[model samples]
Target: MKVKDKVVIVTGAGSGIGNAIAKHFAYHGAKVIVSDINLEKAKKVSEEIVTNFGESLPIKADVANYEEVKNLIQHAVTAYGQLDVLVNNAGVGPKQMAKTAEYTLEDWDDVIAVNQTGVFYGMQLALQQMTQQGFGNIVNIASLAGLKASLNNISYTASKFAVVGMTKSAALEYAKTGIRINAVCPGYTESALLDQLLATRPDMDARLKRIIPMQRYGEASEIAEAVVWLASDSTKFITGQTITLDGGTSL
Candidate 1:
């Protein structure tokens, strides 16, 4: 019940890590906003939460759009009467354009639009509300790639690094306020995105085991758990840091 009755908005909550975080928040008694670009998927997640007797609302939003991100916060505030937490979890990756020189400008732009600009939009909008209320928490979903680097996946790595940087800067900016901002850098986790990446490399699983030290992929729920802790009042003193949940990959 760490987040009990807290109003939380999790972007890209339709599936994968985002979906798990949304459900986790609901299970902990938080009012969850299940948002995604796909209305159907968002609705499905929200319905499941409601069926489980949790408070939830489904909304379609393309975080890449600043206006839509603004509206997302507005809608959440309208429904819940206050904003408490925000998880900027929506992101996109290039299919086969991981190579820097060979990648098209469109591919780079698409990835940056969602992974980087989207986080900015969410933070700007959420900060507006939180600053006014004088209390808030934001968890930006970064990747271990941000701390290290993934060959050929330059766009994603760079974007996540930006998110980590923003998290630290914003945390410092609002340290005196009752707001906390942080980033979670998860390693190769079990998700559709991992499946897609694995499809490209036949030896990925074995390679991951050899390198990760833990010899296993991180679960979405594991990442979600860390996010919930960061959002909770129990960890109010923790801010301006990047929590790496990478199964010792960084080590």
Candidate 2:
């Protein structure tokens, strides 16, 4: 999975899984564009990559916004001359976990805006650029909730399921167009998001681990490695598939 010299754009790269993916790509010699709604965080990651002798640029963008997403794609193309890969990794979980009947419309809207609509914006904009260049790859960061019900988190599950469906639909449409689209579904990974969930319910950590056949949570780096491979030429024959990295949680 050689990504050397490839221009890759990873959204929501300020922290967590997005951060891991950005650094992983940089370490593999790809020119990574680290983007997030938080400019400072994005800059910090970009600087760290540069300090490590990797090429990167920090761009502040709210993926949920169409104009910002458009500008982000333009900036990357302007800097690298061509867009090679776009990791639609920007996502958000629900602020409060609730069952379907108890879920508020406000929470549902908020989660869908960032997790689902944001991904659509990135894929749509990236496809435009990739079509012109005749080749590109998109690796969307989904969740195991996308594959199965997450019990209390209705919005998060719905949004991720949308991502999975979107990935397959787009992949088929662009299959012969030289642009590949796929998704990685991680389960209970160690991330700031997971920390927040654990903080709310201190006992959830163990309960979550017990469900996984491997009896452990996944690591962000492990998810990142899979993402880089999917985005690389090594997965040329792979498209429209959602590779689950959830420690057999789905099993």
Candidate 3:
């Protein structure tokens, strides 16, 4: 019940880590706003939350677009009296693997639009509400790739690095305002994105296990747990930090 009665907005809550985080917050007694580009998927997650006797609202939003991002925050406020937590978890990867010099401009733009710019929109809009209320927490879902560069993942790495940097800068800016901003950098996790990445590098799964001390991929729920803790009052003094949940892969 760490987040009891709080109002939370989770972008990209249709599936994967986003979906798990949305449900986790609801189970902890928060009124969750489940947002995704796909309305159907958003509805399904929200319905499941309600079935568990948790409060939830489903909304369709593409975080890459500033207008849609604005509407998302507005809708959440309309549904709940105030906003307490925001998890910017929506992201995209480049279509193909390529060295930095050979990466396509189109892929770079697409990835940056969703992964970097989308996060910017969410943070700015959420800050407006939280600053007025004088309390809030934000958890941006970065990747271990943000901390350490990966082979042939130029776009994703760059965008996640931006997220990490932004988290620290923003956190410092609001440290005395009763607002905290932090990031979670997960390693290889079981998700549709991982599946897609594995498809490109057929031997990646085994390679990853050998490198990671845990010898296994992380679960979406595990990452969700860390997110909830950061969002809770338990970490009131913690800000401008990136929690790496990569099973020692980054080590």
Which lDDT values do the candidates have, in the order given?
Answer: 0.93, 0.94, 0.94
How well is each residue in 12-123 modelled by candidate 3, as lDDT tens digits?
9999999999999988899999999999999999999999958999999999999999999999988897999999999988998899899999999999999999999999
**Candidate 2 segments whose C-alpha is farther than 4 A from its true place:** none
- Model 3 clashing residue pairs (backbone): none
Candidate 2's residue-wise lDDT over 178-221, tens digit each? 99999999999999889878987869888888898999889999
Model 1: residues with Cα > 4 Å off, grouped in runs: none
Please give me the total number of clashing residue pairs in predicted model 2. 0
Separate clash counts for every candidate:
0, 0, 0
For candidate 2, the 10 contiguous residues with the lowest summed lDDT are 193-202
lDDT of 3 at 176: 95
Residue 247, candidate 2: how far off, in angstroms? 0.6
Instruction: State residue 248's C-alpha deviation in candidate 1, in Å.
Output: 0.5
Lowest summed lDDT window (length 10), candidate 1? 95-104
